[model samples]
Target chain A: MNAKEIIARRVARELKNGDVVNLGIGLPTLIPNFLPSGITIIVQSENGFLGLGPLCDEPNPSLVNAGGEPCGIVAGAAFFDSAMSFALIRGGHVDVSVLGALQVDSLGNLANWMVPGKRVPGMGGAMDLTTGARHVIIAMEHCTKDGSAKILTNCTLPLTCSGKVQTIVTEMALFRINNGLVLEELCPGVSIADVRNCTEADFTVSPNCIATPGELI
Target chain B: MNKCMSLHEVKAVFRDGMTIMCGGFLGVGSPEGLVRELMSNGAKNLTLISNDSAFPDSGIGQLIANKRVTRLIASHIGTNPETGRQMIAKELEVILVPQGTLAERIRCGGAGLGGVLTETGVGTLVEEGKIKLTANSIKYLVELPLRADIALIKAKRADRAGNLVYEKAGRNFNPLMALAADLVIVEVDELVDCGEIDPETVITPGVVIDKIVVSGGY
Candidate 1:
């Protein structure tokens, strides 16, 4: 499957009923389409709306996203001030959060916002969602275009959130961070040796940790 | 003596239990007219959400003093003494979101994205366990986008078309809010003929505005 489809399907499979989810930019944003239609998950954008669904074509003034983009209205969506949007998060109303990251360290530290020497816009809401979400997941490519491993021994960039990452899904593998590093699963085409060669972080492939896609199920 | 409406006929809009998003780094361009109206309405169970609850008997603080608000969702409550008191007395449900997260969430609500994921409050009290796995490593707090049933916006000027231009400080939260509500009621200092406003200065178009409330009298 293509990267977008693969990522979307995986994300959809993890969702449960009544799960209030935050889908970050890029690949993570596509999960709504693949979600189980019957188990309606309430999509919450930090800007201030609840019950966000897939983007619609209608011009409803009440529909909005974090980047200020115009979108469609879903059923049962409610509106409030931006402050209340975050209140739902800080108050522990959200069920799950999915975001993109530049790198993931062995300890699950995330560096998604800023990098040294790159004049970055101020960090938006990455820090809050990391600590706020009940389960945190990172989705990104396995390596940079220059082949620099995104799964680093440690993040060298500015930290958006500390060791809060629960699991990571990349083009090459699905790794779960336990006490330290555990290679939970790998993509079909990749081998255990392939993951070892690709990742920079140390891994402990306990019999329970290492699996290839269907092997986990 | 009959008095003509002043050049600055600022009108503030407030309704009981309405959610207001005020612009400014800290109460800088808060609409005075709306604040007064809220005080005058003596609304109750108000759920206020803002960057900071205004000052003592000022901005939103006046409402807090009158016991109008039952809950507060804000980045910081330090600026308002009355808000602090209300919280300590358990008179308010004070849910404090991080500063940047609040802004983005507002922007998100205005933009119509599903929900934005940021690592903002991860691993902290901001949002500890409310997360999910889309991938293996990235965790994000679920920031529900917010929109008000009725929006009270402060703008500097407006054209007959309803496009608005806000003075500095006033630009904070009004523009994003202009599109994120069921009713966008603008309170402007001055109103002009359609097309009279400089297109560049028009931050929020009248198309999104439902009502043009006048500002304070001259």
Candidate 2:
């Protein structure tokens, strides 16, 4: 599997059956495809949908996710307006929100919305999803295109949320946020040395840290 | 009383400098027919409040394309290149609000509240000019209410009394816009008598609506 797929598969294992989860745009959107069969999780889109399905084979102009991408609806799907859709989020009714991040710090601060001096697309429900969801997961690549680490001691980009992330799944490793970042597992073919070289932030490796399941890799 | 009107009549209510709140998420629940008519009428320098500017050929995007909008208060405009170009060229003023904060501000306007307190933007650029308040050892930014001169809404069905029911996610900002505007105009696919639609099914009531436009054969 490629890096994005590996990260997505790892994040999929964290999902619980019947969790009302919100998947942020990009890599997190791939998690639904990797979920184990028979586990029913209601996917909520902040653009106003509950029980969201994957991208439809036949695209409908009117049906789309918050990213404006065409998607399908499940059997129990229900639609609402943006106000009530956000109310579901800000009210803490959503269980988990898995999002892609540009940078995640040791303190779990997320910076994904904008980069200074660049054109601002503006934050679209990201701040709310990060703050309101019961569990926030950061799913991203381990490094930037220039081979610089994305996991840092402190984020330099504008923050989407401060110290709100609970877990992180990257192609190289899995991390849990406790008092500080904890290295929980590493992807197959990746050694502790590789993680140490790529990660800029300091993390304590869990005693039982294991390699990712072979099937997932 | 009957609330339905002709498209031309509704178009007459729009002025060049009006602040209009349009309901939709990327054109799904937007009042397309009314928007088209407004574009045709050549209203200029209007302020728009919406969730997003949508794409170039869709929803509020048409207005931004026509250069009718001089200012926009929305959550995102990345999907619309025209909005970005206008902002860059200094032809338009864009105020980006967080999606949830934008919704709550509209809700507060409808509910007659002063403002809402939120921790969504405490340390970011979003908090640059906003008032910060502290309660119970937590700090919150005060997001003020947003009200508009006119609101354009789209609905699935409406009764003669103007009670409305929206279709799926197309319902995004319509109901909230209906409550926050001085005048509410709804464009609907189906129109029935007052008793035809169940009261429990109505999302926006007749009393809040000023005019209803039947989008024939849509």
Candidate 3:
């Protein structure tokens, strides 16, 4: 599998039945395609609705997600104004919110909104989702293209939320952000040393850590 | 009372430096007719609040490109590089608010509340200069109510009385904006009679609306 698919599949494993999930744009948006069989989750778009359908070949302008991409809606879906839409979010009704991060640290700090002296995407709803979701997970590639670690001891970019990330899923491994970054599983053909080489943040391997099977179950 | 008006009449009420709340996500639900009227009126030093600074060629971006807005408060401005350029050049003062908090602040302004306490920005730069109060030993940022001199709204359908129904995701910041301004002007798609729209589906009641302009050019 490709890197994004591996990460999305592993992150999909983190989801369960009856989860109302919010997937951030980019890699997090690929999650629904790889959900384990029999797991169903309602999707929430911060722009207004829950029960988001898949992105379409022919998209409608009136039905775009927060990223302004046209998409479909599913059965039993309801649309609302922004105030009530955010009320559900800040009210902690969302079960899990998966977000992409530029950098996630050992302290669970996520910095993805801005990099100083560069173009910044203002925080749309990342702050509320990180602070209010029952479970918050960070999904991103393991490192930059230059082989620099994105999992760091401390974030160098502006933080979306402080100490809010609970899990980190990457192509190399799945990490549980408990006391610190805990290496919970290694991807196929990836060893502890391989993850260590890429990860700048110090971490401990879980005693029961297992390698991802070549085939997704 | 007849609330319908022409673009020229709407422009007459617009003045320089007015704080205007425009309803839209990324231009999907914006009152482009009203926006065009405002631009043509050439109002200056205006404070504009909305969900986003839409693309440079359309929506609120047109206002910014024309050098009308002085201050802007919104959730995101990433899609509009012109807004960033203006902010960087110190021509525009951009205050970024979290989407939920921005909504609740406007909701508070309309609902007669003084402020809203949320943990949305409790540990970040957004907490700067804001009151952080604790209840039950938990801390929250006290976001003050945000009100505007006028609100520009776009509705899919409306009664002559101004009761509104919005379409799909297009309903996004419009309903909230309808409540949070001194003068609420809606640019609607279809304007029916008072009894035409069902009361139960009226997303925004006519009581708060000051004027209506059925969109001339969609």
Which whole-number lDDT from 0 to 100 does residue B182 have in model 3?
92
What's the true lDDT of residue B139 in model 1?
65
lDDT accuracy of residue A191 in candidate 2: 90
Q: Sort by TM-score, best first: what order?
A: 3, 2, 1
lDDT of 2 at A211: 90
Q: Residue A173 of model 3: what lDDT?
A: 90
Rate residue B45 of model 3 by lDDT: 95
Q: Per-residue alpha-carbon lDDT of model 2 for B96-184, expressed as tens digits?
A: 89999999999999989999998887777789889999999988999999999999999989998889998877888888889999999
Of 1 and 2, the candidate ahead on DockQ is 2
TM-score of 1: 0.56
lDDT accuracy of residue A134 in candidate 1: 86
Question: Which model scores highest in DockQ?
Answer: 3
Q: Fraction of true contacts kept, per model? A: 0.17, 0.63, 0.79
- Model 2, span A1-217: residue lDDT tens: 7889998888888988999999988888989889887877999999888988976579876788878788889899988777788889978999999998889999989998776545667788988888789999999999998999999989999988888999999999999989899999988788988998998899999998999888766
Q: What are the per-candidate TM-scores when only chain A is compared?
A: 0.90, 0.96, 0.96
- Give the better candidate number (2 or 3) by lDDT: 3
lDDT of 3 by residue, A1-217 (tens): 6888888998898898989999998889999999888999999999899889986567877899878888999888899988888888878899999998889999999988876656767898899889899899999999988889999999988888999899998998989888898998888888999999998899989998998777652
Top-scoring candidate (TM-score): 3
Q: Once model 3 is optimally superposed onto the true structure by TM-score, how far is the C-alpha of residue A11 displaced, in angstroms?
A: 1.1
**DockQ metric, candidate 2:** 0.68
Instruction: Please state the error at residue B202 of candidate 2 in Å.
Output: 0.9
Candidate 3: the clashing residue pairs are none
